[model samples]
Target chain A: MLWEKEMRVPNTAVVDGKTYATVLGMVRDDRFIPLELVYKPKPGDNVVGIVTNVRHAGYSIELNLPYDGFISSKFTRVSFQQGDLIYGRVKFVDEVGNADITDAKRLPAGKIVDVPASKVPRIIGKKSSMLNVIRDGTGCSIFVGNNGYIWIGGKGNLPLALKTINFIVANAHKHGLTDKVAEYLNEHGGDVKVPPREEEKPPEEKSGLSEPAEETPEPAKEPETAEPSEPSEGEPVSEKEEKDAGSSEEEKQNPIMHSKSAGAAEESGEVKKKGIDIEEM
Target chain B: MEKPELIKDGKRLDGRTPKDLRPVKIEAGVLKEAQGSALVEWGGNKVLAGVYGPRECIPKHGADPYKAKLKIRYTMAPFCSKGEHSRSGPNRRSIEISKVIREAFEPVVLSSQFPRSQIEVYIEVVQAEGGTRVASLTAAAVALADAGIPMSDMVSAIAVGKINGQLVVDLGKDEDNYGESDVPMAVTHRDKQIVLMQMDGLLTREELAQNIDEAIEASEKVYELQADALKKSYEKEERGKLKL
Candidate 1:
């Protein structure tokens, strides 16, 4: 017979005049289980945290959320010191100039979900096509809010959307969807394309101008195009000679150069020129 | 009490001749949280030992700048007593046994490395038939090593008792009471150093010498078992690494 073990949740405790639920339990991932907190913590709540850094008076706390929240020591309890996780509340949003957050408990739970920072771009999709489907399918009011919080969960679709979001976030970098996150969403379930947000347009325009300016002025771009064309010109004649010498060198170096400098080729060329000067000297 | 018999044909009461020892099984690092721990079984006798240590000396007043203090405590459960004796702190016999055990281990342990720190060695006798003190001391040494305490050598001990006027390697409870003499010795197995020697009842000098030789031989066998237990612990640690 299989026995099910039930854990008892602790009685409600008052913290800062608010009743908060606390349950002592184990947190399990694919690997080991760690003793941790299980509670519903909203944003802007006065919570205790440990000071991970004293210079900036910064402190971090698990907050019973998927990720830890950070706060400055100025908002900390009196005995606050470096290396101390102390108590603090959100002292209002800096953007709104509301330094008083004494009654900010109603600000809602800060989004705790995180995609690996490396994988965030994939879930956002190239134009956010994948993200829209995820938002629509799960019916989660999805918002990749600034400050690394991916706000998720709304009404009935909360659970489904959360699962899909977690799956996408966990494997975003692995599937090469960092740039085209919308494609990943469509492949998973949600078929709708999210309208590209206006915020992404500025960076796209900047890149478009920089790309033409760099390539149009460079003689190096022509050599790359000509080399491949020559291979097709005198197929058998050049094949053997090229294979024994030029082709081997080109093939061996192309992948190394492409993988290392694909995103910053112009900067790499400048570095290479300086290196040659130093070597000659 | 009946006198134990020994035949010219080389047979004993339990059907083993002279120079024979009871079966010994040793396991190290048995307790998860202890720095060093072990459980040893010799025939019917069972002993468990836990070693905590080289930690900061508590109470501040107990701190010594020159050498590490070895606190050896040997305790027996109520069930291990002869009858329904009330459980209490260390008895006179246990105090004497602890003193001898501490001496046996001192020469083998590199205590100087942990200056001013205290190494607490706790030995619990779960079941006792005979030769419990010697068994417990040997088990403690094994545990201390398993806890990663550096010791010059492993300590091995055994008891030799005279039954029916003949020298025997290890004594069982029945033979011990009826026996004419009993001798317990702890030896450092690596260097063959005699760290502990104690006896009760009378024996001629030559006879005592012979018994000592026999006890040393039996201890060497016990030392081999100790090494085997250490090897098994290392193998278990290796398996844990693979899982990680």
Candidate 2:
């Protein structure tokens, strides 16, 4: 009873006729999983976190991670507060253990938000351009982390910023999103700068069993070749991907028909033309 | 009352062989509002699994400061079966099944990762034939994964039983009524660890081992379906094809 494929756990290699599970390195341990599924903090990566606990030493923050992180008073200029949202950098990952936050700043007057970890890049735009749009338009300073935690700070445009970011987070998967976000920003605040058109840069991360197929394939078929090798390597794997892709196309054509994205459907009930048949819980 | 002959020659009542399983289909992200959900149709059973939370524990007291807690509820809809609508709420049998379901998943979920938070699972048996528990467990596993909860493996379950003195795989409702022994087994595939096992009626040592082996084999197929459903979900989400 051995699973050859998933047995990355050296701990599970049979010893004395017993299987002992191993907690492999959280990073690069289960290479099969997309990077979004595993949490690994790199030095200087921006992070947004909520203060889950306030200690005499400092505050423990939640980055939507398994472990609460500590932002030590070592570098804090202001007093730490509980339940407050903080934005900072991963200054150092004790790759030996948990990473410590440095240059931490509290965001007092704004909302802390979330998107699926996988969609963080989409919200951050092609290269922080999307994030910059939301920031400049709403006059909010936004920080997005690999964990999908977002800290949005602003007074004049706090509400607008939250709405815009929420929209982007909710509909991050849709195309023509940069235009949509820019349009919404301009309509709400005549002063906010709206970019005419955004350059859609397919990320450089699309190597290996990467997302080039699903992420950019909708608009262009050129990326299709990048994934053919993947499809051929494991025929069954590609077959499932094809079936899912087919079903997704079916849903897009008839969104109101059945099978809506859970995030979009959960946002509001009034969006439906038939309206009010299904009440929000 | 004449007993239904569960198997004739090699085929069962549904024309399935002794080792044949009921057809199973799974769809992930079936419910809105729930972080993750899935619907599974196996044989005549329709089960929906919904996952919510990893948020603050309600009642403010169910929190475990160190590890995320799991609450698994299994309910059989009142009209799930013929002629009789079950009363809503947790019955004794449902409670026991719920407990077992919780234990079945507790080992697989990376609950400790989200301390003091609770991830809840709601398994609604829209219809039940035989092996509703197994079907629901299968669906729950997918729903948990669909929710993007970290896990070592997805647990899959199937029931293999002795019907008309013949060991069979995936007993149907009719066969269950007349079956001499029924065993439901769940294993976390990556680990091949049996997380849940329950037996009803009787089996000798040798028969138990043999049937357990059959259950293990059947579970592998179940795992394939579960994995397929989960992968389909992420792929669909990736393509922005998800309606949400």
Candidate 3:
């Protein structure tokens, strides 16, 4: 009894209140036809169709809405073997179920123009400041490729946002980033740019001890040594002059006696007065 | 499984006369997350190993100031078994294999550079046809390189067996059980220094020397493949960074 065909059918069909049936014969294909070959169908579109005959080039999907659709191998990124049941969106439909299938669930708006790879560093700015500014102003998701391919997409004001990005990238090196972006938006009629202000420097008034206390000791020591030696030589000069004849006798015995008067005269102001008196004589 | 006869048309299985080795293919840094990893396939046997670290020693008590400790664990996965699942953990056979692997790598690895640290080597036997321990040792050396660990030279290991009273290189499971003797040896592919060596069963002195010579030749071929794999992984990493 368990081996009967009826028992097998029930087991296959009954699962969680959903009934499934094996295709005894080919059902009518109800898939959609893509309007443009490159364009993908929008998301949440129902794909209902019967594949009539699978071929090497593409699958001929027939829809109940009278549109005969073709799902080409070129349109799909995934490889399909024979007897594969492909699920895709129906882009278009006529009365006769003739349709064209497309794997592209959604079409992206505004593709990136090829920019030079070297220019990317300038466009992105240091730490991505340029990119951050564009994203905040435009409300768009921008992806920049290393090879200079940029992809930008979002809902409203997409064209305007794209134009702004292009302008920013073009004039990046000339005028610098923050100032140029601000000037461009003001001229072209977009959002206004807020400039940051400069910081003020602190005051540099002088304190009391500018010269420093440690340096004062050096100048005072030189004068004290010069004054003490001069007075001692002046007192010895009168005695030496009175004993001049005796001094020559002393000089023969002691060589120290001859130079004592000359030493005393040089230490006192008498040496300058004696030179003036010699010039008069 | 019935064992294949050692001698047929005066040659062993896979049509090699005595002293022929199984083909070896080695690739390093197969796993991106691991510090060092390698996948080595010696004939039908496939083995992979990952080297974790010369990192801070765990359990604190395991730290030794004398030399850098090597924590090695060799394990065979369930799929490696042909029959029922074998008991897991450090079995006597696995422990012996671990000991042999540790000793084989000791000379080649500059352990003194990493004092008070531990290097963890995890060898996984992906497919067990035969000569897994030898394959594991060879793969582990490549894994250590992939992890960027400094080594004196690459360790290359090969299993040489005596079949039909004649020495052969790289015995399969059938040839291993019926073969007369097996000597698994590891050597530094750069300087030809013997790091790890062991023989089981029986062999003459002349036969053992011949086996060692044949093993060294086979290991050099494996070393070339390991170098190529490491080069490819580094190139791939450079490409990934360029994309971002």
Ranking by TM-score: 2, 1, 3
- Model 3: how far residue A264 lies from native, Å: 90
| lDDT by residue for model 3 (B143-192), tens | 87655454545677878878777778888877788888888888776457
Name the better of 1 and 3 by lDDT: 3
Tell me the tens digit of each residue's lDDT in model 2 across B14-94: 899988899999988778667678999999999999987676666567678767789999998998988355596798889
Query: Across residues A1-281, which tens digit of lDDT does each residue of candidate 2 receive?
Result: 22223232221222234322221111112222121232435454567888888888777888765456778886788776778887776666542225688778777766666666655666776546676677778777776766667666655587787777666655543434565677688888724554644344323122222222333313332222332121111111111122222233223223221221111001011122111111210
Q: What is the interface RMSD of each candidate, in Å?
A: 24.8, 14.1, 43.1
Which parts of model 1 are misplaced by more than 4 Å? Answer: A1-281, B1-10, B81-84, B237-244
The local lDDT score (0 to 100) that residue B198 gets in candidate 1 is: 88
Q: On DockQ, who's better, 1 or 3?
A: 1
Q: What is the lDDT of candidate 1?
A: 0.51
How does model 3 fare in lDDT?
0.52
Candidate 3 per-residue lDDT, tens place, A1-281, comes to: 11112221210121223222210000111111100011112222334334566678777753322123577777777654433333455444322223567662222444544443333434454334555556656666665533234556676356655666666443322213444554455456556443232210101101111222232222222111121111111011111122222233222322221211111000012223223222322
Q: Enumerate clash totals for all models, in the order shown.
A: 17, 9, 23
